[model samples]
Target: MRPNRVSLVMSWLAMLLMGLAGLFGACGVSAASAAEAPIELRQGTVTTTVDGVTRTEPVELSYHWDRQHNGRPGTASFDLPFTLEAEPETPWGIFIPRVGNVFEVQLNDALLQTYGDMKRNNDADYAKAPIYVPVPGKLLRKGDNLLQIRLHADTARLAGLSQVVVGPAASVRNELFESANAWRFTGSVLLMAFSLIVGGIALALWLTQLDVDANGMPRRVAIYFWAALAEFFWAVRMADGLVAEPPLSWGPWGVLMAACYAGWAAASMMFVYHLAGWANERRHRWVRWPVAGVVVGTVLFSALSLQRDEPAWFTAWLAVELVFVAAFVGAFALATLRHPNDDRLLMAGAALVTVAFAARDWLVVRLSDAYGETTWVRYSSVFFGAVLLLIVLRRFRAAAVQARGSVAALAERVAQRERELAATYAELEAAAQVQARTHERERILREMHDGVGSHISSAIRQLQSGQSSSGDLLRTLRDSLDQLKLQIDSIHLPPGDVGALLAAARYRLEPRLASSGIEFEWAVDEVEPVEGLDAHGMRQLQFLLFESISNVLRHAEATVLRFEAGMKGKTVQLRVIDNGKGFDTTRVMPRSLAERSGAIGARLTVESRPGRTVVQLEFD
Candidate 1:
């Protein structure tokens, strides 16, 4: 399959899988209640040493102990008092919904379970969903049981505990399942998966739509490309919420997560601004610089946060993201109000939904002092991605419609051009026919001028000079008629064939030569035909031959005349020789014959001396 088609298929497949997961995830399967009784431990006492100062506090199981201590940073252990009616042989366990940093559960001063190393700077370990530790039945007393929890925490963060429960293994398992299925786990997984799939599709669409011009990529495509990158980074950052532990060290992971958040917000702002078509206006171009500055500032803050181990830098980054989100939402809303189009409206709705969820999560994180509880924001990304998909689909549909219209227009143009060409061809054909008729008439007139008219004029001149008698005049007229007949006969010879023209000339001239008491010798060699010997060229050649024979018969006083036509390579050679008392060639050759032979690309020569005379014509 083509790359675009493959990308489209995979995108659809991912969407289908997401839909299926959402469907299955929302449907809860009820399991039987735990086999043993359950108890909620709501009272405990927390003691700790900070800067070599000892402190003690009484805490409730349902409250965050970190708040009771004025949010101070320290290592502490919580001692809880509980009672067991009987030391049952069945397994008993404790379930804590959440914990801060590293902690260990001890049953009656015996280590039951340890989570995370207290010495390691594993801050993210506190963000885990729930902790379940199995209490050995042998360690459980028949009357009173003590459970201790040791925790390590950082400053300005929540540490200690939230609601703790003690029950049989089955009850603890059920509670753990319930905690894991909380909105944070399922929602983050869904959002991350959806973001990845949509990001892939968006990037693919951006690649396919990339238009390169002299000025580089168009601003609109660039905006969409950046939007895709933002979604991809958002997906990567959300992956941290899906896992129980950090994939990398806290410092690097913190930097990466911060950068991703900053990048996502910045790119989203740009995408919305451009999508609203405001980016095209000169006045709005300046807005992008400040937004870019904010993004760069956030990135630098993230790096500083990592280097200095300061959470304030990260908090500032979050504030920047919130400002970006607010601006993006406001811009989209204003665009929707101005344009009131379906696309703009959809984008506005998506932005509003995302911002609303983000605000709610922000409030929850601040009030509850928990990171894992703010999952609605991730879920909101689905709406945003859907809107982007719709936008791309609409663009594709519009392009397809425009393409079909262009093809139809091109076909109409081609048909109109064909009609015009047909009309032009008809006009050229008529013009050619008129020209052919004109040329034929001119050819007939020329033949009359050279044969009959010249002969008559010669006769009149002779008569006016009184150079010949009536009988001689009659003979000259008869010879003129014969010449006219020869001209007519030459016209009927096949074109481009030297031998046929030679035979026609001989046929016409033989009787006249024989009547003059001369023997006609006709010799023609079988040779390849010469091309481009048209009727006009043949007529000129025949006229030259006939004129030569006539001159020999009338004035040479010769009895034998020989005419030979043959091929010399690619040239045609014709020679007429007479054994007669010849005259000087320079005086006997006619200017008209020389000019006609030259016009037809033929070489004409006459050699006459003593009792021999020769006329030669060669044509290529």
Candidate 2:
């Protein structure tokens, strides 16, 4: 838990940090008196000169400057004189693990190896890298051999060295510095690659959410955006260790690294705020002030790096960054404790462990080790990535469930509407059937009254007047029964059957015509059925025929009575013609016959000429 790491991790939480092996490089490490072990050059004289103040001290296997010159720019020379019995082997090497930022090695005044150019401010952080440089076999002598380590120091990097080991190539390369090399160089590359992949996918998913989904988490699952932003910035910040020849030089690259570091910090806080559902106006400003401070601090730190004389300005910057980091870490820890789930709680626990590591760095500051700002917190960045993924998946599952429910609800509504429509149709059909039955009943009553009732009234009138014979009264009653039979017989008749009425009337009243001494004949033609000539129209036709037959028997006094029916073009014509002592042809029409003819839209005409008369009806 470096202050920056625990804070928004503003210093770039997963920065390429000093190697773990560098922490214990000099502790209890020795080349014992064995034939195969290397020779340990522990005994040496160290000369330090800083700002014109020079001091010399006896050196040990591990050494550092006095605390007074810790952050000052200075130089140190480690003159290590070793006595060898003879040139032990050829093509040997020297292993000096965890030195200052830069240094060089010499054997008998001949420059043997260099870490890098110490005079320039390069992009790499050499304090993290272990030193294993080759020494020539020709430079070694039997006695009075000298090994020198010339070290350069800058701000924040104190004059220091671990033990020096002069041994065979295998001992120096494989035994001492191999594991340190793996952790510092190889591990940094792997972490950068892994973070880049994680960051890239997170970024893509965030972009997809931004482009498509509009609901779910507030601001459309914005936690993914923050998580992606944090991871992407961290990946590039980690590249500071592996990128030896960067695209930009030291000043611009440092500024870039600072921006990425501060950006990661702000994004992580934003992600946490959203995760806890605390991104309201109150807590939002809490994030904003710190972010503003980081922006200002980055600008100031960039300005400070440009000044060569202000080597201690870096310590000032780190001290101020410490204050910002402390406040951020406090707020972050509080929020983490108030997190919603076990996953976030796990992240908090990792931060706490990293805090313990950073606490060790604080307690042992005078120890002047390269584990100053370690990457212990970076070990748990996976927790953040995992939680972001979980939120995205959970939101997607919920959206799917809601969509399915909506479809099911819509289907149910459609089914309900269809059922209602079907019920309404059934009701309408039933109403139409009831109305038709009512109309049919009325039609039957009208037919009985007009035909049967008319005949019964005539029979009663003859009896009451006391002028009718028994045969005549009985004939009128029989005519009433015939009218009822005709009404029933016309029920099965189709529309526009012009001959049906004449044929039925002849069958019923033929006996009467014979009793009256009159013959009856029929002449009708087949006609096509017509629309609108329904059962009611047929009843009207029957009444007309009955009335006309009764007139021939009572008044015509004829020998023959003939009924004629045929189609005259599109019109249907029916004529009742009789030969007897006929009545006057030119006279007012009988109201009963005229009324029914008009009701059925039939034309009634009468013609009389001494011995013949005809009542004609035409229907179009």
Candidate 3:
């Protein structure tokens, strides 16, 4: 949606366009015709005075000071004497459609109104406006009345007065107001405000996009720069005309006006050229000379106006600037006609209309015979500028919307990629779990081979050799059973829990050892788990302890068995002690126990004596 104020302005502009014709038509009914007893439209004589050489011209319907007194600042007067039956009512007025840079009106030698002070400094140019003045009935004698109009012109200004209409104040009031406002009192003010606000916004946005445009490219920033430059100075030019009292004197004010025009024209040409695809580097290089000439000419004109007394220098520079404007307008119209688009055609038409009006105004200023004509460009350009402003706003809004769409599309792509990554992570996690389960199965098989298989093999060997009775075979088979119990118990043991490991082996062997008349003493101190011990390492230690017990039973001929496990100062020691008539020390310590202790990074030792024997594992 458009901003609220912009929407309101567009709606009002549409309404204005729809009623423009009717509005002007109603205003066209002149007061000279509208009065009941209309004042006769008659010829009047104009006296021109220049360099103290007074010249009187023939009476006509209107007056124009010819080329003889043109460039010099001069005075001109129009005198109209008429006969009336009676004195008119108190509030009679006259409407003159156009005057000069400044003027004063008098009836019967009494001053009625003066539009400007003619103070010789900081005076405004009223040549572009129409004026109406009310009259005092006392000035209208019953038999004769004299209406004199006086005007002052600047060094280059045209001195002219239009045909006058005398009637009741109401008769001339509306028409005069309409004609004056036609010179763009309302239109220029509105256009100036619109251009300033819109141009400021455009320039600010261009600053943000210093090297890029709404399409995220580098091309369109130039377009925005040109648009803002043209509009800003156009508002300045409009302000020069709109203000009643300029900050500078008339000469400097006019010079500033031309400079503003030069700036606006150059910027407008570049703006249209870029839009129409005529802004290649080669064309810009060719056009640069003319644009530079305009700038140089403006500076030269300013210098000359201050240095010299002639008005011709100012006029020449201004005319050169107009030629530049005409060339650009021609190129724009030709391009639009050759390959028309909606935006190009609209701008082309506006260019043609505005330039045509400007040309008429230039003619009225240069031609001696042209009189009573207000400036046309003052009105036409403001209206065309409004249309142009609307076009720019539409394009800017569209670009903004497209940029937003691009950002949204990029965000959607990123979100899709994140979802894909999340799914991939889940698949990887599942694969890792399957690999871990397979490794655990292999570890379980290795432990069962070392513990249960070894026990059963020892039982089979004793039976084949016939070296033991049925009781010995029974104890050997039971040891194999205890290995199975330890394996089953290890499945639920926490990682590196040595205490639970020792407990499992003790529980299974206690009953059998007690039945064999061996007292079992279990001593378990508060022990910390070994650092870096893993599931596989715990299984090795479990089987090693079971093998130690077998050694005590089979070889030590032990009657008392003691198992001790705990942390001792900095070194942890676990031992199995038996009190018996011991066997050979070398034979009692199994090679398997030695290998298992080395696997768990502990040392294995065995000591055998007549009264006692010990199998011990030590950890540093």
Cα RMSD (Å) per model? 16.4, 18.6, 16.2
For model 3 the TM-score comes to 0.59
The residue-by-residue lDDT of candidate 2 on 1-620, one tens digit each, is 57755765644533424343544443323222233357888888889889888899887767654344655667789899987665555467888766766778888999987766777654344556677888776777766888998877655433477778887788689877797778767777776777677667667666665323335434445666777788787777777766655677555666677677667666766766666656654746566676667657765775575445343454456456556655665666787666546546655554455445544444455244433233544444545445555654565566568768977999999999999989998998899899889877777787677667878989989989999999889878878887788888888776776666566677777877887788878677776565566777777767777877777776767899887778789887788888878776556456778887888888888888878888898887
Which candidate would rank higher by TM-score, 2 or 3? 3
Candidate 2 Cα outliers beyond 4 Å, as residue runs: 1-33, 52-56, 61-70, 118-125, 157-160, 210-220, 245-249, 281-284, 305-339, 358-620
The candidate, 1 or 3, that scores higher on TM-score is 1
- TM for every model, in the order presented, reads 0.61, 0.54, 0.59
User: Candidate 3 residues 428-509, lDDT tens each?
Assistant: 8898899888877876676667667876888889889987789888887888788888888878777677887788877778
lDDT of 3 at 198: 66
List pairs with backbone clashes in candidate 3: none
| CA displacement after TM-score superposition, residue 48 of candidate 2 (Å) | 3.9
Please give the CA lDDT of all the candidate structures: 0.73, 0.69, 0.74
